[model samples]
Target chain A: MLKAFASYMTYEFIGLDQGSRIGDVLNFFIYDTIKIFLLLTVIIHAVSIIRSYFPPEKTRKILAHKREFIGNILAALLGVVTPFCSCSAVPLFIGFVEAGVPLGVTFSFLISSPMVNEVAVVLLWGLFGWKIAAIYMVTGLLVAVLAGFVIGKLKLEKWVEEYVYQIKTGQGQQVLTQTFRQRLQYARWNTADILKRIWLYVVLAIGLGGFIHGYVPQDFLVRYAGNGNPFAVPMAVALGVPLYSNAAGVIPIVYALMEKGLNTGTVLAFMMAVTALSLPEMIILRKVLKIPLLIVFAGIMTVTITAVGYLFNAIL
Target chain B: MEIKVLGPGCANCHTMEQLAKTAVAALGIEARVEKISDIQEIMKYTMSTPGLVVNGKLKHAGKPLPSIEKVKAMIKEEA
Candidate 1:
């Protein structure tokens, strides 16, 4: 249906010539935009409902005081389902820390939370095939778990702000229990909220993708960031660090890069690097984590994300 | 009655505070609505941001701010 509409709009309504570049790009943009938005709405609403059950408090409870190996695994998985934003990072961090949750486990949650999400998954699946999307998710989780494990072993607790240890969160915290109807309401609002925030990014991304598909020559970036380039993955990760974007916003850009002959590993590395580490998020985290711990976290993330990019590039 | 809105001052936090103020006025209730942005004080109530505390008791926490009706209902419960 979407394909048919896109075709009709491009060929019949717009009256562009067959096989014309403008027609092709217009078709691509129209079809992908509508299709992706539809996918995003449905998936985001469902994910919101599912996420309602795993609030940060619950996620913390699930991992608190658990053993390290299993804890990192659970934290990574929970990070995907837990819906807390970076704004709540400090309290969430202090909450987890005060609850005796392992710092590494918390790191796993922090790493995976922003980088891997339903929106990113939906965007990837919509643009790329399911296999690529699956690969991205699995690798993201692995990086989160592994980096978190390494951080855990580093025993850098002292690097955290001293105030995080001394400040005791209030007990007898009241539970603002939601009814099923309330959950549904929350999901509806969440879907609207997410769409409002990212719709512009999605549209711009798809627009750029269409433009690239029509105008950009093939192998444009392959020479610089192709599989043959030994430094491509590291370089891509390095470029991605200062830039900030959520997974949804970056996937289309990644798609454009992938289309322009960038190696899969390099582009994917760039996407992860952009999402995983951002200047704003680092500053927000700085309130609780001292500069050294933040630096170490950033370093490990850069290395792990770069490795994942290289691994996938080599394999596929 | 005193009600506090706890958050680290994100966009949603402001909305939450607004919803709260509007709820109090619509109900015509004499309640002090306080905005709590201090991280240490916020953790004393809830781990999540944009938390709603009615009379120092947590009523709602986290995103997807409750409807004005719901806020009024919560305030009514405290009243």
Candidate 2:
């Protein structure tokens, strides 16, 4: 449906030759912009409503006192639905520890919250197919779960900043109860807010994709980061660590890279590294995690994400 | 009356601070609204960012931030 509309607009309305490169690029750009924005709005609204049910307070209660592996899995899954912001990282970390939620479980939540977010999922689904999106989600969860469990087994709890454990988050925290109408309103506002923030990135991504599709040679990226290159995955991961961006913010670049013949695994790894292993996040987490633990966390994430990238490249 | 909005100065915290000020004005109450961005001070009250403390009582905390009307009601309750 979108393709037909885009075609109509590019060829009939704009009076461009149907076979022209510009016409094809314009069609792709229009179709993708409409489809992606629509998908983002609908998915974000739905996810927001679902999120309204799983606030951090409730999540902390759920993860508290759970066993190690089970807690890790649950925390990783809960990370998907819970609303997380870096600003709240300190309090959430302290609150979880104080609530008796295990350190590893909290790490699981922390890792997956930013990595496997709704924005990334929707963008992946919109740009690639559902299979790629599903794969990204599963791999992301596995990385979080395994990394957290490893951290747990290593007995790194002592490495956390002592102040995090010392701080007693006062009891009897007030829970805001909202009616169904309020939830809907909140969802609407959240959708609008997210869209407003990400629209520019989406346009830039699609525009880049369109430009690549129209003007850039198909084999341009293949020459450097193609499947034959063994170092592509690691190189991508290494490059992604220094760059900080949300999932949505990085999708356009990912889309362009993929269009230029970058393998699925390398691109996905790049996306994960960019979103999950950012230096700024490490600095923020420093308030709760000690230097050693932070370094270990970064090491584990890089290795896991790099491995996932290579695995996808080999198989897909 | 004193209202303190607790956060690390994130956007939501700012919004909550604005809402508190607007609520104070709407109710025509003589209330002082303050934003506490210091992590230590915020942690002392609640672990959640964008927390609202009305006259030293924790009123609300965390996301899906309350609307202006709800903020007003919370302040009125404290009053």
Per-model TM-score, in order, reads 0.95, 0.93
Q: Write model 1 residue lDDT over A97-140, tens digit each, in one string.
A: 98889999999999999988998888888887688779888998
TM-score of chain B of each: 0.97, 0.97
Deviation in Å, model 1, residue A236 alpha carbon: 0.5
Residues A219-300, model 2: lDDT tens digits: 9989988977999999999999889899989988999998898998999999999999887778888988889999999998
Q: Which regions in candidate 2 have their CA more than 4 angstroms from the true location? A: B11-15, B38-46, B55-60, B63-79
Cα deviation at A303, candidate 2, in Å, is 0.9
Candidate 1 second chain TM? 0.97
Q: What TM-score against the true chain A does chain A of each candidate get?
A: 0.97, 0.97
Q: DockQ, in order, for the candidates?
A: 0.67, 0.45
Per-prediction share of native contacts kept: 0.71, 0.35
What is the fnat of candidate 2?
0.35
